[model samples]
Every structure is written in C-alpha cells, then in structure tokens.
Target: MGKDAPYVLVVGAGAVGTYFAARLWQAGARLAMLCRSDYEAVCKHGSFDIKSPHGDFKFIPEAIIKNPSECPVPPDFIIVSTKALPEIDVASLIRPAVHPKTSIVLLQNGIGFDEPLAAAFPGNELISGMTYIGVTRTAPGRIEHIDSGRVALGKFPRGISQNAQLLAGLFAKSSVPCEIHENILAKRWEKLVWNVPFNPISVLSRADTSAIMAHPASRELSRSLMEEVCSIAAVAGFPLQPGIVQKNLDYTAAMKPYKTSMLVDFENKRPMEIEAILGNPLRVAESHGLSVPNMRAIYALIQLLETGCRH
Candidate 1:
C-alpha cells in the first residue's frame, strides 16, 4: 500500500465487517481489525476465507488485534458492524482508536443507531451506512456471502461529506453498488421496511425467505408489517417511495432461500436485535399517535422470544 493509503480499523470483525473490510482492502485501504470470537482462529490462520458471489478471496489485514487498544495505528475510518443491541456501548468500544479526524462509520441496523456515537464523539464525523446484503459468518474465520452487497451512506443528521464520498468510492471500486444519499436516515427507514418484518418473522416461523414468501398467511402478514413501517416513516418525515411494500415483497419472493441474521442469531442461542429492528420503530409510531397494530404485535412477540432465548 502507498504511504497515503486510507487506514481503516474495523471494530467488529463479524461477517458484515469482514466482508466489507476485504472489499476495502481490495480498494487499497490499509486494514486493521479488532475482533472477538473469531480472534483465535483468525490469528492462527492469518486471514479470513471469504466465499462470495462476487468472487472468493483471502483477506489478510495489516493487523488483527483482540482489543481496540491494540490497534497499531490511528485509523482514518472506524467501521462498526456489530449487532445493534442495547447492551453494546459502541462509542466506548471504539473510543481508543478514534482520532480527532477519524470518520466513524456505522454499518449496523436500527433506527437512530448513530445518535449515541454522535453524542460520544461530537467532534468526529459520523458516517451513517445502511447495507442491503445477505452475508454471514458460518464458522470462525469463514464467511458465506449469499446475495446482494449494495450500501447507502451519508453523514449523520443529514447531508453528504468528503468522508462519506471517500468511503463510498472504496466500495464502488470493489464492485459493490454504493450510493451516497443526501438524507441517509430516509434510506435507513426504507430498509427497515424490509427488516422489521422479515427478520423477526423468520425467527418466529422458523422459516427462510423462500418459506415465508411461499405461504400466503405469512406473506400477507409481512405486507401488513411493511405498510405499518411506511406509515411510521411518513409520520416521522421520511416518506418512502410509492409501492415500496410490494417492491420489497417481490424482491424477497425472488431471493434465494436463506436465513435472516436474526434467525441465525436465535438458532445460535444468541441475543437477537429485537429492540433495534422492532422496538425503536414501534416507539416512533407511538410518539406520533399512529396505530400500527401489526407492528405492535410482532414487536411484543419477538421481545418475548428474545427473553426466552436469554434464559
């Protein structure tokens, strides 16, 4: 890499983080990773084995440290791709490597996921990223990419910036369709139109995308949930494009039979992102006095399911 190559520290080296990190590395960014569960296996192997539709590749970062404090150098970009559960204090987790000029990129899911980080690092630029992809870590140091890898990004609380463009350019070069939006929060909410229903329903029904779409009752339920999300988004001043609900349904119907991230977490006996995907949007509906019965019901059931998993 050149002396002026962008130094990036991926804070969560899970499936999403590892895949994107590998792509950025292909785009000529200097990479360092702060990993957790896969640390031992990755260290032993010296790289991650990425299986993808784009192409198979071995991703060897410049450094792989178990803690943020162990990061060898200050990074220009800090990518956080962990599950957006309430317990994770992402701001503090990456604080050790956040330089004054570093751009913090959040690649997780959730409404208002960037607020805490923004509050924690008031001086640093926060890039809000919404990824539309199906990738998972099937084993330690091994990732399986199923389908789709497009991403939309923007500066938090709105508008584009140089930092956003630089990051988007990297992904674009790596063959991932990357969009820089003037209002990324709208993009986030639009994604929630798909996530809010499918993720939890997958867990509750023990079904993949194919199974869910194949059954008429579950299919309609998914549609209702999506419409409720659209209503909430519009009330919150981020109205979606017309026919978005049907568009999402059609897309999912054509998608390969695959498990959702939440379903995978549930089957692994791990905490699902119930609060992030469901709780946050439901709160928005309540605050706006909008009635979203389907959303409310699903949220309650998923929270119950998550609680059961914990014990």
Candidate 2:
C-alpha cells in the first residue's frame, strides 16, 4: 500500500497462518503466502474465505507462491506456522525468502523447538511465538475460527525486541490480542501445561474437551498429567504459577466441546506432532533427572496410536 509498508512472507499458509496473515494485512502490511495443499483452491477462489467469531472476511494476498524461492522479494518478516513435525525441515524451507534483516517468526506449538531455527539463522532475529486458538482449515481456501485467538511472542531464549513489538502492534491494530514477552520459552512451557493433557488425551480417548472434563476418570487423569508437567517445568527452572493445573482445568471445562488439532490430524490419517508436543518436554524432564511417568505413558500410548493409524 505504501513504500514503507512491511513485507511479510508466510511460509505455511494453513488455517493458523491464514488467520494471522489476514490480521497483518488488516494492519496494512504487504503479504505473500507460500501455500501447498490449498494452493489450487486458493488460486481458483482468489481469496481465503475465513469464517471467524472475531469477523468473517476474504483475504487475497499480493502473491501466492508454491515455494519460498518464488517469493517476489526478500521479506522483512517470515512467519513460519507449520506443524512441528520432525520430518519437515522448517529452517531450509524458508531460507530462500530470508534476507539479512528478515525476522523469522515461529508461530507454532510445543517446547524447545525454536533451537533448530535459531541455530540455522544465528544472525537473524528469531521470534518465538505461541498461539492459543481453536481454528482449522475446513476445506481448501476456507477456515473456521471458533474460539480464542490470542498470541504471545518474543525473541528466542529471552527478551523482547523491536521486531517483536512491531508485529505485536500490528496484531493489536487488527484487534487480535498479542502480548510481547521477555521470556517466551516460559510461555511455551505454560501452553504445554494444557497441550500436554488435552491434545494426546483427546486422541487416546476419542473425546473432546467437554467430554474429557465431564468424565471423572478422564478429568483426574488430565489433572495428573498437568501436575507432572508443572513439576517438570519447575525442576527445569521455569516454575509455573501456583495453581496452573486447576486454572487450566477450569478454563477448558468451560470451553466449548472442541476437537484438538491432534485428534483432527489423527482422524485425517496425518502425522501428529507427537514428538514436539510430548517427546521434547519428556526429554527436558529426563535431562533434569525428573520423572514424569504420566506424560511418559501418554506419550508412549500416543506414539503407538499414531504408528498403528499410519499403517
């Protein structure tokens, strides 16, 4: 729109990417999206038909590229919102569009996952991001956003920077709540407090949030898992709030019955983020000589579940 408008290239234009891309667009940034599965549909439709409680709108990006190398220009920011599956080498995927000053933003899930990206681009600023939202791509070029869509982000390892603040301001202008944090890793661990319990449990039990909360046995199991995660976080030096487990339970219990992303991936026969969500934290626990038997059991069961489903 202007000579000074920031250029943002979104690497994975899935539901999460599209939603936030739309926000950035609303804040007047120029956008180019590197899309895959929905490329044909999005190209044919000429827009992303986003249906959200916040608002419903259609977004047409400046360019729809099939590869990062096809990016029209080097971007000031590259937002990588891909699933944290081990097989996807995210660092290499966005390398082509990265300029010397490009701020690489990791808008993804899980714990301790930013290390690889930080390692890959030591010179570039790495913004660690965590999004809390209930969203999905119901079909090609279509998104359904049903619940909270807040985000917390900061420079990787620690502290907030100008890039982080600028992006947060853009999201805020678009009316999406975005917080800049001093230590985003702690926030990731905080999110894992919920993800650890609900995500895997949803897949293992074939239950949504409400059903999981309603059942006495499942509820207790979830509580135990949360406690284990809190313990692990504490031992690892990022001690969580005093009543995180119960606080998470209360919030989820009151939430709309919703299928987790992991469950949705399982039903669709896609690879779940088992390693990133469960395995990585478990490894951290082990490094600190902490025992998280509940997480270990759930992690094992989910891994087996994923294996059986894939075959």
Candidate 3:
C-alpha cells in the first residue's frame, strides 16, 4: 500500500459506491471514482453527505475518472459496486486503475461473478464482499443510510491472502463492523437468501420491506422462497445457516420500513437487477434439477412487471 493515503477507485457512483467512498475518504483514503463527466456536478459542488447508520461522515474524492483513461496510474485498490448486469464491463473499466497488486472488491449483489471476474482480471487480487446496509441516493452526491450492517469479505478465490485481509481490515475500521468470512460464497448465497424473496416481490408488488413482510401470505411466501433458495445453495455446496427463514423474517421486521433497491428502480422505471439478482439463482437451481416454484413465481412476475413498465 502507498505510504500516503491509499489510492482507491470506485467503478460506479451509485448508492453503494458513494456511501463506502465517502466513509473511506473521510478516514484518510485518497479516492477516485470511475464515472461519466456528468457526475462532475458534484466536483463543482465540493462534496456530498450521508446519514450513516453509524455516525455520518463527508468527504470529496480527489478525482473522478470519466472512465479508465482518466486514471493515468493504477489505483492501490479498486472497488466495483455497480449493479450486477453492468458488471459485465468491469474488466474493461478497471484496466487503467488496476495493476498486479491492486485489490478489487466487488460489492454487487450476487454469487455468479466469482470465477468470471477473477478470469477477467487474472493476476490481480480479488475480494468478494457483502454489505447489508440499505442506502438511497437522495440526489447526486447525497445518500441516506437508513440502517447499517456489517461488511463481510474473504473466502474468495484466494481466501487467506494479505490483500483480502487488508481489504477486510480497512472496511472493519469503518463505522460498520467488518469480518473475514471463511466461506464468502456461502455468505453471498446467504445475502441472496433474503434478496430472492424480498427484492423482486417488493418491486413487483410496489411494497416496501414493512408492507411486504407485514402481510401474512406475502410473509409466508417469503419464507418458502428462502427455503427453496437454501435447498439449492446446499446442493451447490454453499450451506446456509439454520433458521435462515425465520431470521430473514425477523430481519425484515427489524429493518422494517426499508425500501429495497429493486423497489426504487421499479418506481423510477429504471432497469431492474432481476437478471443478476433473481435470474442467476433461478438458472443455477435449474441446472441442479432443484425445484424452486416460489422463486420462479416471483421471477416471472418481476419479468412481467418490467415489461409492463417498459411498455
């Protein structure tokens, strides 16, 4: 790592990227973001604010690359927090900001990218991470963190490496708790454990966390979806924690009144992450010849809803 502030680049200026960048920069990390020139609006305005689940902290990035070309030198670390579908272009975007030693942290919500991403940027260290915090962009350069959660990293292609540990350690130092997960894939699937049920159904039904979980039928449906997912995960060698169903229900209750990102996208008519978030798991389950009726139903509804929105 650089003796001076660590040079880090965030691929997307979306909610997750913005929240983490602000906190890391506040803690004395030199940050750069990969974004379009339009985002320069924040540059002129100075910085943005976050109502962190922990206390809020604010800072301005030293530079924001319109793309990789703007970064003349590779960053000490690169964190890509873009939505799943857009992740297809990460290798191309991070080229300028990546060296053999640059550690890449992916915050996208899905487990399918483990091998593909590592293959895309071979020789560079990779860390698979999951954060449960819910955040929304109130405006350009401004984010609201409704509730906070820990970030888990490690147990990736190279689990116990110093780079992975360093990545986990830096995030642990942040306001939210952080830990090294021995089985990051299981952790990733565990995140999907809730998302499979909550995200798509919420988006399609136009319900927030509270509305979705409060209703009996919908809540029961959520549990069935979770059980189906846990079954597939077990077959795929990623065993979920016991009581995942009840835990998710309890989580939704405690994290009540939260609006999932998919819900936000549906309301805004923006492209949803169904392909990477929902479709990926469904496909994986089918390949194993597993039954996932509940997920299939939710996935089908989200597809129909997205088509309706577009039309």
Location of the lowest summed lDDT over 10 successive residues in candidate 2: 1-10
Give lDDT per model, in order: 0.91, 0.91, 0.78
- Report the lDDT tens digits of candidate 2 across residue range 1-311: 57588999998898899999998998999999888988887888888888988779988889999999999978999999999998999988988888899999999999766999999999999999989887888898898997888999999889989999999989999989999999898898999989998999999989999999999999999999999989988988899999999999999999879899899999989899998889999999999988999999999999988888778
Better of 2 and 3 by lDDT: 2
Over 106-194, each residue of candidate 1 has an lDDT whose tens digit, in order, gives 99897967887899999999999878787888899899998888888999989999989988888888998999999999988999999
- Segments of candidate 3 deviating more than 4 angstroms: 1-3, 51-57, 86-88
List of clashing residue pairs for candidate 2:
none
Ranking by TM-score: 2, 1, 3
Error of 2 at 11 (Å): 1.0
Candidate 2 lDDT (Cα, 0 to 1): 0.91
State each candidate's clash count: 0, 0, 0
Q: What's the true lDDT of residue 281 in model 2?
A: 94
Residue-level lDDT tens digits of model 3 in 133-239: 76888877778887666677784653566766765556666765777877788888888888888888787688888998889998888889889889989998888
Best by TM-score: 2
Candidate 3, clashing residue pairs? Answer: none
List where candidate 2 sits over 4 angstroms from the true fold: none
